[model samples]
Each structure stands twice: as C-alpha cells, then as structure tokens.
Target: MGSIVLTHLKSAWHVDQAILDDEEKIVVLRFGKTTDAAVMAMDEHLSKIADRVQNFASIYVVDNKEVPDFNAMYELYDACTVMFFFRNKHILVDCGTGNNNKINFSIADKQDLIDIIEVVYRGARKGKGLVVSPKDYATQMKY
Candidate 1:
C-alpha cells in the first residue's frame, strides 16, 4: 500500500506549487489515473521509496483525468508517466528508451526506481538538465 502514503495532487496549481516550493528535493510527479494497472504498479514503487528518498526527492501523484491541466502540456497520455522537476525546471533522463521526458512504463522493481531517482537527484544538483540513467531501461521497458 505505498499509494496510501503518497500525496495526491488534484489540481494543476498544487502541482505547480509542489515543484516550485521544493528547493532542495527533486519533485517527482507521477501523472496518471489511480485506476490504471500500470499507474498502480508505479505507485507501489514510489511509495516504497517515499521515506527512503525524502531527503533528496519529494514524490506526488497526480490523477491526469481529474486535473487534465497538464495532460496536453506534458503529453501525459501513457498509462503511467513519471516526471522529475528541479527548481521548477523539468529534468530529463536518458533512459536509453528514446523517450527521455519521463518514465512511461511501470518499473517492476523498487530498487530500480530508487536508482533512477538517485541519478536524477545527483544530476539536478550539479546543474545538469539531463543525466544518463544508471541502467539501460530500453530492454527492461516494453511499453
């Protein structure tokens, strides 16, 4: 039940504020509907790292259907999409999956998700807009 502990952003304004307010931690936003299987799986991984990564990352879940404010802007049409933000700027990751904007597929393992978050945190802290993922997700991701 990681989803139980994760905060949900129901409005675009709240989502925007979350990214802007966190100066030290990387704002991780999971954009998707709670009812989707992929979204549920991703939320599980997010919840697992909620406490462990709190010092460097802040996680939030946004129901795209409920908000719909960022759907068009962020191109959040996938079953589950995760985006990283630092200092109100969108951080990109080179996942070796062509799509660097966000992790569109559900990561089955918790450690893998944690590793990715760590990479983003380190890169963002260094003033890098994009960083390479530690592991190649092209093979691991099928969606």
Candidate 2:
C-alpha cells in the first residue's frame, strides 16, 4: 500500500532532475525494483514517513533496472538502497553498517528511518557532506 503511493523516478533524466532541481528539500531516493521484496519493504517505511518529513525531505524511488544510470556511480548492489541528496550534493550517513555511502538494507522501524532523515536534514542544512546516524545499525540488537 505504501509503495503504491511513493513517487518513482522512471528515467535517467528524471533521476538527475530530482536531485538537481530540488533546492530546498533533501531528495531521498530509494534505488531498486518495486517488484523486489526488500525495496517494497523500504518503500513502506519511506511512504509512512513521507508526509511527516515533507518539510525537510522529498522521497523518491528509482528502479535500477529502468534507470541504471546511477547504479554503478553509487555502487547500488543491494536489494534495496536508500540515498540522500541536498542542494544537488549527495549526502552520506554513517549508519555504522561499514557502508556509509548508502543505506543498503531495509530499516525495520520507521522511527529509525525518521531519525536518519532528521540527522541528514540537520547536517545538510549546515553544509556538512556527511553526518553520523542517530542509531548505530551495526550495534543495534536484532529482534
């Protein structure tokens, strides 16, 4: 249900424009296929918080197979990858997952996702290229 509502970047140009054009809000892009389970799960979390974070972030999902333009550049090799951008600059978060380049896993909790986006928004507004995630994914106890 959530995945059905989130906006998707269908082309390479749309993907570039989404990052390049949105000047005020952080552009959050989820790279993967909508048909994939992990990507759909991530989209659920994202869409759940879409309205809540609209003041500072704009969420968009892109199908890697369809766009394919940013896959190699961003090293998108996971089932689902969530990336952030601010003022046309890529925003990196230290999720403690060894890979700060992008969130390469499905965040189980939506609050966890909100925390990350808030951290990114605050840090990017201050002109910081990278920011530490609120919770360390590497250390969080799994249920």
User: Superposing every Cα of model 1 onto the true structure, what RMSD results?
Assistant: 1.0
| TM-score quality measure for candidate 2 | 0.94
Q: Which regions of candidate 2 deviate over 4 angstroms? A: 139-143
> Cα lDDT of all candidates, in order?
0.91, 0.88
| lDDT (C-alpha) at residue 60 in model 2 | 96
Of the candidates shown, which would achieve the greatest lDDT relative to the real structure?
A: 1
Please list all clashing residue pairs in model 1, or write none if there are none.
Answer: none
Model 1 scores worst on lDDT over the 10 consecutive residues at 134-143
**Residue 85's C-alpha lDDT in candidate 2?**
99
